[model samples]
Target: MKRSVLLLLGILLIVLGVVSIGALKREIRISTNVTVSKSEATSFRVLSSAEQISSWMEGITLQETLVEHPENVGSRYRLTQVDGSEWEATVLDLEDNRRIVMLLTDPRAEIHIEVELFPSPEGTRVQIDTITRGSTVFYRTLMPFAKRSILKSQMRINEHWKRLIETSIESLVGEWSGTDASGSEQLFEFHFDGTADWKVSSSAGEFQLKNLLYRRNTLSQPQQLDLTGFQKGPLAGMTLFGIVDLSRQDTLIYDAAAGKPDDASARPETFSESATVYIRIR
Candidate 1:
């Protein structure tokens, strides 16, 4: 049987997603939470609904291959990414606006991947936690070494969604609110036509709200994003020497410890942590 490169790649993507354990209970849980310029509820609403996941994970190519685009309990799908990596994932659990658990079962790469979306005062936080319990001692020991580096890279890849959305906002698509969940007023008439707001400063350097704008164009294509209102504040003038590519996904927030670049006078000078928000804001 002839196999297309995409088909074979899709098969391997899913295989790499799993890190097997013979008696390890078939479970591996690792998570990374990231904040975007959206809501916990809204972020969950999108990501938790596995059907919409490909919007943020555009690199995955086989999403449309799922049986029903199933996202509910026990819903399963076989997805292949742009690189031809594929995985067989089953929906293990789902909690609206809180959590979504996905299990990828492949002997070569058996593991559990759970992703959570959080709404913060600063932005929409996303957590991709994973769990991989190896069955045998030899298998378990080698699992981390074989997978952790790749796992970290996966987190950064997903982080790219935040960057993509912020770019849309900075490009001036529309208005967005980055206030954390605590401040969200149900009373306000807010609509996310996929818009965002951004600011520049000395301490944090240049940071946009993490509200990723997701939308469709008039032709109903995947043009789902908008950003606007670029402003500078007190922190805008601070000198920045560190860096974080909010535009790049998969770079986990907790893991990104480098400082950022900031300049009040548009010329490098004094800088401080105040120039950057510890979290990866848009």
Candidate 2:
């Protein structure tokens, strides 16, 4: 009787293993969409550019081209994540200003991503579809529990891209002035060449305007101005990250506070704080 019981247990284990292996081999697909306030051509341009793609995907340090091509099809890239993980991606298909399909090769699994852009009255509607299959039995068993988180991450990526395409550099060029929470006078000058100047006056007297390199923060919510100081001044060699809201064509609301840098070597000594409503002075 004991021998029979042991044999049955072994058979049960083998059956469970087979079931797990089969489940792991199953493919799953997820789809999501986001709307951006830009023409389809503009949106497609941003999506295809490696630099812009890296900026839109938060925590991705950079993407280096392994193989480059003018047509974009067959182009391969190596993506480096913030955590130092790496992945290989290849452009499987490309339709100018319409669609892009990419294959991501990772150790755990292989994923295919398809992006489609449609023109809308508000701007461009971006649809993203991702499909993947688990490669290992352990990974397959975890897929059911992990699938939701994976879909959420894809949604977040789309949202980041949407925010970035909506607030291009062209929309930010000009002069704006406002008052801080402390009733201090604040002024900002954004140039077409991607440079900016900021000045603020408070009880401590007026601070000199510092030259800054400004770019759109693609990773942040509601979109914001990413300012990197250039010369030696109060904000020299520092980043003043701030949120920008266009209340109207003529009015802008800006808010920012101090924060620590992710890289210790790049940390700055001083920073500034402000929450002001700016009117276009230009």
Candidate 3:
């Protein structure tokens, strides 16, 4: 009887161990596909290296390279956030433009993220899989809640990539020209350096433009073109801001307006009644 009781106790302990281990680990997967070529989609993922994560992630301010690798795998990076928190990540696997896997190590837990790309009928399909593990009991209990947040973060990152692939900077470069409602000839020259020049020929005489800057806003649907400038000459230092709806088509449209200034500057107080359409010249 005593021997049988001891054997039973040992079996119970083994069962408990397996259950505890299972409770400490969790996995989540999400996928999204966009109307972009596989090459474009894959390029976006490759460029999102540890060093360039801050460009897409809102709170990340800096990323430091801890280890360098020729094929990207085995490379380790440290990322610092705006709130002074930091996390360490390592590249676990990389298969050229096909897939990338990263291991993110935080103070509370560790997560393994895998991103895979495949060609699709529409364009490219991207799938993200995340596995989270925690050693402590407290963290294990919070895994359910943590999983929700992790999924949201993953979706946000994927959306950023989709927007970037849709409105790639390369496609926006070159000269674009159009005419306004009043038959004014408008010319915009977008340079590779992110600077643009605007020339408007109207009955009111050509308005000199300065401080032209163009940026693509990835957070919005259909994406957005953010144009900033200043009217030169007597209206020097006057602010010009325009939010243009960006479409992947050949034509882009927007309404340019002069922002109100506290200082004295002879600038237009209101924007044009109709939107101006610009067709790609090159």
TM-score of each: 0.43, 0.52, 0.47
Give the runs in model 1 whose Cα sits over 4 Å from its true position.
1-29, 52-59, 64-66, 69-71, 81-85, 133-141, 164-282
Candidate no. 2 TM-score: 0.52
- In candidate 2, what residue range of length 10 has the lowest lDDT sum? 263-272
Global fold similarity of model 3 (TM-score): 0.47
Candidate 2 structure quality by residue, lDDT tens digits, 87-178 = 78887886656787888876877778899998777867999998877777666666666678888888888887877776653255556788
| lDDT-best of 1 and 3 | 3
- Candidate 3 stretches with Cα past 4 Å from truth are 1-50, 55-58, 168-282
lDDT of 1 at 31: 56
**Selected candidate, larger TM-score, 2 vs 3:** 2
True-structure lDDT of candidate 3: 0.62
User: Each model's C-alpha lDDT?
Assistant: 0.46, 0.70, 0.62
Positional deviation of residue 179's Cα in model 2 after best superposition, in angstroms: 46
Q: Distance from true position, residue 127, model 2, in Å?
A: 0.8
Q: Please write out the lDDT profile of model 3 over residues 107-184, one tens digit for every residue.
A: 867777777766566655766667777656667656655667766776777777676665453245556788999999
Instruction: Tell me which residue pairs clash in candidate 3.
Output: none
